[model samples]
Target: MRAISTSGSGLVDVDVPEPQLRPHDLLVQVEAVSVNPVDVKIAASAGDERRILGFDAAGTVVRAGPEVTGFTVGDEVYYSGDVTRQGADAELHAVDARIAGHKPGNLSMAEAAAVPLTTITAWESLFTHFGADAGTTGTLLVVGAPGGVGSMLVQLAKQLTSLRVIGTASRPETRERVLALGGDATVDHRSLAASVKDVAPDGVDFLFSPFSEGNIETYAEIVKPFGHVVAIDDHHVDVFPLKSKSIAWHWELMFTHAIYQTPDMASQGRLLDETARLLDEGRLRTTLGTEIADFSAAGLRRAHELVADGKAVGKVVVTR
Candidate 1:
């Protein structure tokens, strides 16, 4: 099998044996893959052993294990594979059936590949962590709203919840993109606290910060008393300062369920199924901005470089 494996700080093409399937796994013939920040982070810390570095993948099922029931051979599926296992950066990949979802019929392979990791993060952050429900009337601020998860967050909040959506973007073009994606208002991220206060004097009801680190104090100030703040990024953030306001801080990691083999591992699949329906109905859209035509080591290395720079507007996908 042809695969791109991490060799030190970069990727290399290697011909390796196909993976062994588990009782609940599906052997997928991968057609497309998306590069994410986790890929770069993992590559940097990887040891001498070659590591496959991808999670978001869209492909067709070639075979399913005896315990698999969700999909069959030739079924098109998409998923962010479990982090504990090898990734989907190869011609053939094995993924747990419980975490896989049927791909949106209207989307191409590359488009479907772009949806899983970011969409899962956004869905879990909004619904699970922030506790956003339909018909809720309040202001929700999405910090760093032009990136992959941020774009998905903006659209989902606009379409599903009644919360007034405020997105943060430092540049004019990114701000415009946020507005087009259904943000009720856009604020300059450089001037986050004041900009948020200008829109909601009392402070926002919910805050989703994908880039929360040094700005923890600013977030504490802008969020309402007893409000929820959901963050996906890993950094040193002191929540003690937010105690005065009674603000609640939540962390969302998309890999938690699968990594632990939780009882609700199947919920991830359900979430992706719902997202696929929304995409097929045109209520949601893909954030695939840059497409790399080559699916080789060099192409993946370039994609990793762009994502690591932290300036890419949307998801980067490579197609076979």
Candidate 2:
């Protein structure tokens, strides 16, 4: 099987053996894959071992494990595979069926590939951590609203909840992109506190921070008393300031369920199925901003470079 992998010299194209399928796995012929910040981070720490380096993928199932019930051969699916295992960057890959979902009927393979990672992250952050639902009503602020997860987060919040969505973007184009994704309003992140206050005077009920390093103070000021703050970054933050207002801080990582083989791991598959239905119904849309027509090592490297630069407006996908 032909695949791209991370070597000490950097991303390289290699021919590796087909992945061995587990009892609950689905052998998929990968058609498209998306690049995320995690991919860049892993590649940076690459060792002499050649490790496959992709997470989000869309493809067709060629074989299903005997225990699998949700899908079978020939079904198109999309998923963010478990990080602990070899990834989906190959001509053929194996993924646990419990964590994969049927691809949205209306989406192309490339578009579907762009969704899983960001959708899972945003969904888990907003619903699992913040406890938001269709009945939930309040002001929710997204700090990095034009990036991949932020774009999906803004859309999911607007589509599934009664909350008022406020997105923060520093550039004119990015602000416009956020508004188009269903944000009620957009504020410049350069002056986060002031800009947010200008639109949400009473302070927001929830804060979604994709980059939470130096913005803790601004978050402390912008979030209301008893509000919730959900972050996905790895940077250390001092939560002491939020103590005065009794603000609850949470960290959401979409891979936790898969990594631990949690009892509710199947919930991610169901979540993706629901998201696919919404997409097919036109209630939501794909965030694929850039598509690399090539699916080889060179093209994958270019996709990684774009995401690592931190300026991409939405998801970057590499397709066959």
Candidate 3:
């Protein structure tokens, strides 16, 4: 099988053996994949043993494990594969069926590929970590709201909950994109505290920080007393400041269920299934901002570069 693997901070084409499937796995023929910040990080940290670096994939099931019940051969699916194992950068890939979902019929393969990882991250951040539901009513301030996860987060919060959604974006174009994705308002992230306070005078009830490194103080100030903060980035942030206001701090990682083989691992599949239905119903939409024409080493590298530059408005996808 042909694939792209990380090689000394870059990607290179390689011919590797086809992936072996486990008892609950699905053998998928790769159709499209999306690039995320994690892909860039893993590529830069590549060791002596080269590793394939893709997670968001939309593909067709060629074979399903005997234990699989949710899907079968010829099923089109989308998923973010487990980071503990090989990824979906190859022509054919193996993924656990419990973590995969049926692709939204209205979406193209590239568009479907752009949704899984970001959707999972945003969904878990809002519902799983923050414990929000349709009846939940409060203000949600989303930091970095024009990125892949943020784009989906704003939409889901607006569509599923009664919360007022406010997103942060520095540039005019990005702020417009956030508003287009259903954010009630947009604030400049450059002057975050003041901007957020201008729109949410009483302070927000919840804060979602995709970039949490240096904004702890701002978060403490903007979030109201007894408010909640959910972060997804891996920065060493001290949350003690939030303790004074009884603010609860939580972390969300989409890979947790698959990495630990959690009891509710299949819940991710169900979440994605619901996301697909929303997409098909036109309540939600794909965030595919850029699409590479083909799944070549060069195209993958370009996609990685776009994501690493940190300026792309939404998700960047590469189609096979």
Candidate 4:
């Protein structure tokens, strides 16, 4: 198997023997995969160690473990493989069938590859952590909403809920993209809180953070007294700022379920299934911003570099 491995010093493309398939696993012949911030962090933090760096994968099932009954040979699937497990940056990867889902019929493998990671992060951040009612009437503010997860979150929050979506993007181009993706309105992130207040005078009912900067206190100010705030990044914000307003704070790490092998570990797959239905119905869309062919070490490095610069909107896909 030809895989991209991360050595202690840097990433290297190597040809290693294929992995064995477990009873509950599915052997996927990866056609396309996407890179996330986690891949960049792992690559930069690698110290005298080698790792396969990738997360979202979409391809065909070449073989299935005996216990994998839902999918068989040649089934197209999309999933974000577990971080602790071997990733999908290789010719072949054996993923737990419980985490992978059937690919949306409407999208190409490259397009499908872009969804799992961002979709899961956005879905979990908004619904799981913030207790957002999809059917309720209110306003939702998505910080960094033009990025991959934010793009998906905007569409999901709009389609599945009555909430008027306000997404922040500092650039005029990004703001256009956010609005095109279903944001009821768009605001420049340079002055985020005030920009949002202009859209909804009362206050935003829910605030979702996908950006690195901005204080939680600023979010609290724009939010209503009992509003909910959730972040997906490793934000080290002070708790005191949120105390006075009685605002709820939530942090979402998509890897937590798989890393801890949580009791509802299979829920990731369940959500993918639901998301697939939305895609096929033309309700939700893929966030693939760009595609780098070959899925080589150099290509992966380029993708990571773009993401680390913190300007990439939507998702970056690399095909093997």
Candidate 5:
């Protein structure tokens, strides 16, 4: 099994033995996987070099554990894998069935792999944390709308919510993409507070960002009183200054359900299923801007560089 891995020192591609399957796991023959910022952060930050870095994956089931009833051999599945175990960087991965969902019939493997991580983040941030109104007349400010999670956030907001959708981007290309995806307005994050003020005279109802620091304070200034903030990255930023706006801050980590083995671990599976339906219905699409072949040291390195530089407008996928 050829797979990319991060050792205690650096990332490398190696041929490792296939993984062992647990009673509730599925042995999947991975067809495609998507790279997110979390993968790079883990590779750079983890002290262990043996760490396998990946989260979003879609593949065909080769074996199903005895207790798993959600899928069978040959079923096409997609999932945002648990962070505690090895990932789907290899041709084969033993993944928990509880976190897997049926892949949509209309999408290719690369497209399917892009949905889990970003969709889960957007869904959790908007509904679970901020309690966005799908029918509200308020505004949604998706800062950096060209990002992996941000791209999907715009679609879900437009399709699932009536709230006015505003997206921020520094490039004209990204702003055009955002508008094409149903963004009602576009702002330049480089302009910071001025951008937000120009787009929203009243204020934003929700502020969603997956990018790092420097924009939080400016975001705080544009949000309406009682507006909610949902951040998905490990910005580790301070929000004490936002108290005056009476703003509420929320953090979303897609790995939470599987990482904690939450009682609703199966809920992640359910969310992906819903996303599949939405995709086939033309209500949602993948944010994958780049696609590479298989997990190798070279491929993983390129993926890491894109995320680390914050130049990726959409998710990057690796295909078998």
Candidate 6:
């Protein structure tokens, strides 16, 4: 099997043995894979032990484990594979079927690959961590609109809830994309606090920041009393500033469910299934911002470079 691997120095093409299917795993013939910040981060942190450098993938099942009842051979699936296991940079990957979702019927393999990781992050952040309620009317400011997770968050908030969605994007294209994707309005991230205040004088009811590094205090200031803030990036923010507002802080990491093998690990699959239905119904759309033609080591490295540079507008996918 051919795969992209992270050596101590950098990415390289390598030949590796095919992974054996576990009792609950699916041996997927990978069709496409998407790059994420985690892939870049992991690449930088790679040790002497080589590691496959992908997470998001869309593929067709060629083999299914004995205990896998939900899907069969030939099922088209998409998932963010467990970080503890080999990833989907290879032509074949063995993924636990419990965490894989059926690929969106309305999308191509590359488009579906662009969704899983980002969708999972946005879904869990809004519904599980920040507690967005469909019946409730509120205001939400997505700190990095039109990015992979931000794109999904904006759409989900618009489609599933009554919240007035405000998105922040530095570039005009990204701002416009946010509005087109369902943001009630777009705000310049340069002056996020002022821009958010202009939208909601009382402050936003919730703040979701996919890249909240130095703007923690700004988010704290712009959020309403007892409001919630959720972030996916690592940032050193003093919680004391939030003390006066009685705000809640939540950090969302999409890999935690698979990393720990939690009892609700299968919930990721359920989330994907629901997202697939939404996609087929035209309620959600793919976030494929860029596509790499090659699925080789060079292609993977280029995708990682774009993500690591932090200017990518949406998910970057490379097809096999």
Q: Which parts of model 3 are misplaced by more than 4 Å?
A: none
Angstrom error at residue 292, model 3? 0.5
**Each candidate's lDDT (Cα)?**
0.92, 0.93, 0.92, 0.86, 0.84, 0.90
Which residues of candidate 4, in runs, are more than 4 Å off?
212-214
Q: TM-score of each candidate?
A: 0.98, 0.98, 0.98, 0.95, 0.94, 0.97
RMSD of each: 1.0, 0.9, 0.9, 1.6, 1.8, 1.3
Q: What's the residue-level lDDT of 61 in candidate 1?
A: 99
**Any residue pairs clashing in model 5, and if so which?**
6-49, 7-48, 7-49, 8-48, 8-49
- For candidate 2, the per-residue lDDT at 308 reads 93
- Tell me the lDDT of candidate 6: 0.90
Error of 1 at 311 (Å): 2.4
TM-score of 2: 0.98
Which should have the higher lDDT, number 1 or number 4? Answer: 1
Measured on C-alpha atoms, candidate 4 has an lDDT of 0.86
Q: Which stretches of candidate 5 lie over 4 Å from their true place?
A: none
lDDT of 1: 0.92
What TM-score does candidate 5 get on C-alpha atoms? 0.94
Clashing pairs in 1: none
lDDT of 2 by residue, 1-320 (tens): 99999988888999999998898999999999999999999989878878998999999999988899889799999999999999988899999999999999999999999999999999998899999999999999998889888999999999999999999888889988998889999998889999989999999999999888889888889999999999999898888889999999999999999899999999999999999999999988899989998989999999999999988877899999
Model 1 TM: 0.98
For model 1, the stretches where C-alpha displacement exceeds 4 angstroms are: none
Pick by lDDT: 1 or 5, better one: 1
Error of 5 at 27 (Å): 1.2
